[model samples]
Target: MKEITSTMAGTVLNILVNVGQDVSIGQEVIILESMKMEIPVESQISGKVRGIKMKIGDFVNEGDVLIVLE
Candidate 1:
């Protein structure tokens, strides 16, 4: 399994994919609002989404796991 992590401390603005969703490497998976900017969290590897570790509006820190892909 591959872990998708937050790039910065922020509130999760949105989750673009769901469990079992197929994703490609570099595909945008989540949007985070931090420092008044929108940062996209992307998949690092092509795989199916196995779990979502966060929800919209949830606060997350840098390096926190956001999704699991397998």
Candidate 2:
């Protein structure tokens, strides 16, 4: 399994893919709000979405896993 982790502390703003959905490399998977800015988190691998570790409005620290791929 592969995971997409948060690069910085933030609140999960949006999730673009659902569990079991196929995702491509570079596709925007989640949007994070940090420092009053919106940051888009992209998929680093092409695979099926196996899990989502965070929910909208949830606060996350740097390096926190956001999505899992398989």
Candidate 3:
């Protein structure tokens, strides 16, 4: 199993992948907006997305789990 986590504190701007979707390493899974800048969170491991931990417009902290994969 693998997890995609937020790299910094921010509001969720977008979710690029859906549950049951395949993802590759370095693929953007979520976009977060902080300080007017958009930061894309990428998957470090390739796998099928199993879950999404947050929704658009939700605040997330660094290291928060964004997507679960297996």
Clashing pairs in 2: none
Model 1 worst lDDT window (10 residues)? 39-48
Candidate 1 structure quality by residue, lDDT tens digits, 1-70: 8988988899999999999899999899999999899999878878899999989999999999999989
lDDT of 2 at 24: 95
Estimate the lDDT of model 1.
Answer: 0.92
Task: Give the TM-score (vs. native) of candidate 2.
Answer: 0.94
Quick one: best TM-score, which candidate? Answer: 3
Candidate 3 residues 5-54, lDDT tens each? 88999999999999999999999889999999999988889999999989
What are the lDDT scores of the predictions, listed in order? 0.92, 0.92, 0.93
lDDT score of residue 66 within candidate 1: 94
User: Whole-model lDDT, candidate 2?
Assistant: 0.92
Error of 3 at 1 (Å): 2.5
